[model samples]
Target: MSTTAIGINAAIAVGAYFMTVRMIPRLRDMFIKANLAGRDLCKKDKPQIPESYGVLIGCVFLISMFLFIPIPFAFDEAAATDALTGGKPATFPHDKFVELIAALLSICCMIFLGFADDVLDLRWRHKLLLPTIATLPLLMVYYVNYNSTTVMMPNFARGVFGTSVNIGVLYYIFMGKLAVFCTNAINILAGINGLEVGQSLIIAASVTVFNFIELALGHQVESHQFSLHFMLPFLATSLALWKFNRYPSQVFVGDTYCYFAGMTFAVVGILGHFSKTLLLFFLPQILNFLYSTPQLFHFVPCPRHRLPKYDAKTDLLHISTTEFRLNELGKLGRLMVTLLRSMRLISWQELEDGRVITNNFTLINFVLFIFGPVHERVITQMLMGFQIICTLLALFIRYPLANYFYATET
Candidate 1:
């Protein structure tokens, strides 16, 4: 915290925000001109919206990293001295620069996949596996720069285990799992206009707040400051995207936005060395992921998109699920569906054609089940509101709540 450092970071954040905001229209026009729009046949009155506008975030972020942020701050004297060549000054951002490069490459890979999916319309299998590839670069970086991946136990349990419980090499596997889950969580819990980008914005803002709080508390200043570096640009660009991507959207962020936003979190978590803390902010996304796991794993028929059923007259949305015919299933299958329907876990609707309709298995549908039919925007708000509450709860639990259950690991 020097004033100079504070001023420099603030300038970079403000400048990046404005630059990205100004460029969104240009990016949207480029997508539209290139015929990059989503097929909107799934929902009522939904129009084809321009896709891959999320590339603006990557572009603006990388550009700001290079153009504004200097290589060596006052914090890099040791590096500067180590590189005391014939007056070739130390490079900026220190070792973290390498992590930035890895993050950029990984994000580019994700954006490429998203663009391919948008243009070529790849299937679920491809979507599931491609993001794993995007994470390889980031994961490799984390492996090379080794650190603790130990999960903290309760104090008494830690005494028995001789400190934090180390999961050993299995931590890499866990990181890989984190990467996959983060990439897909936001992607799975989306279909409406603002829900995708809105959640991203909220998560970014939450992380930003966490970073600032850490900085203010005089704890891990440099690391939290580094986290802010990513969070600020993300929040900046996402706010601009949200304006056009809101209800009655001018553009569709598409799979690209989800892939990009999710991986951004992955990058920040890995590079900032706060992966555990980072994961806490994503509890809602994680819960939604868990809630939808059965459908995602194909226990039930998972539709390409779990968009709510829109009522034209009421202007409200209802749950949309796959239904099975009685004749198509054996006794056990029929019994299972019957029980789930009775529990209201799955809805059963009688069709005039002697068939049945079942509610879609997703958090969006679950919200409607609890709250009854409501507008899509309301659903977005409630979910986003829940995300905010979860994030604040995470903050509370990370500190105050820890006094009872467990100690902070690092």
Candidate 2:
């Protein structure tokens, strides 16, 4: 593609961004009228705000995709851009078309699932389980269309054990797991105002930037094209949501945005054939999920909302704690708590009444733990900064691994 093509593509992306921003007010009003608002529980005032603007955000992305890369009958731009085709229909790679179709189907599945969760206020258990079905198309496409799910072992492992070991069918299972984890990981590491979408924006931007660098360096063109197409729209809608969701939020995105945003990334990762690189980009969210696994598994009692305690007076957020009585615990419980405390992932205070309060296990709470009590806004920015740092680190690390273990068209 030439500079003129690049400029045209960018204009389309900017138009999508502005279009989503323009749609938010109407969506906000719609949520309000439907009484789908949620209280800003992190704030002292606990003001009600309309929720699930992701509906429109998803709309913008899907619509933009149709316009930007139309299905055969969707539109005809052959006359304008197909000088080389010379009246022959501009043809897309069959594999690329299949991947994009699968991606679109997967994202659509996620959008409807998110909307249902937003309206139903589904439980965490249901949230985890429901997105599995949404990922079926993604997994099925990978198996039928892409076919090979075998992953090569790391370079170091190859030197030690032999040439790269194929993981075989397990790789498809891993892809399915990746889809579920990506969707839920974002959902879990959220609660702070704009933190969810803010981190998402940074991740999308980082992936997009990395894709461009790969392109400029002359790596695989098709993979990079798929990545840019998926990410540009995701970044646009996320930015638009952040506009309303920042600091003092005008609207809450609820679960709908989280599902849509996360699944979109998953689709890009799978279709672009950069799923491992994609996981690297989400290192922070992955770490948060691992850190919170004890609670997730019921080793520790998990609260419906584990958000940091917000003090309105100073506008600072404090780490919130969950109570677990040591006396009520078995040997396994005592050991788990001690291990987490030793890792400094949690701090606990034993009460005279036999209950112990353990700090909330999340990246947001962990930031509060490390930085001390900071303004809610400050913490949100700090976490987003961590997101950027992690993503950049991933980019730097990916090339070495990809070159040695995963060969690509470069």
List TM-scores for all candidates, in order: 0.86, 0.90
Candidate 2 on 207-236: residue-level lDDT in tens? 898889888887776578667877877787
* Candidate 1 Cα errors over 4 Å, as ranges: 1-6, 39-45, 69-94, 159-162, 325-343, 349-356
What lDDT tens digits, residue by residue, belong to model 1 across residues 1-410? 24355556567768888877787777766777788777554356767678777766667766766653453255355445657655665556535666767877887788778767767889888877887788888777777766566877776676578557778878777777777778888988888879998888888888888877777888777667767766776777778788888887777787777888888888877777677888888998888876676567765566776888888778788888786566776665566666766777766788887787777778889899888998878898999999999998988877887765567634
CA displacement after TM-score superposition, residue 69 of candidate 1 (Å)? 5.0
Worst 10 residues of 2 by lDDT: 71-80
lDDT of each: 0.75, 0.79
Output the TM-score of candidate 1: 0.86
Q: Give the CA lDDT, 0 to 100, for residue 343 in model 2.
A: 79
| lDDT of candidate model 1 versus the reference | 0.75
- True lDDT of residue 201, candidate 1: 88
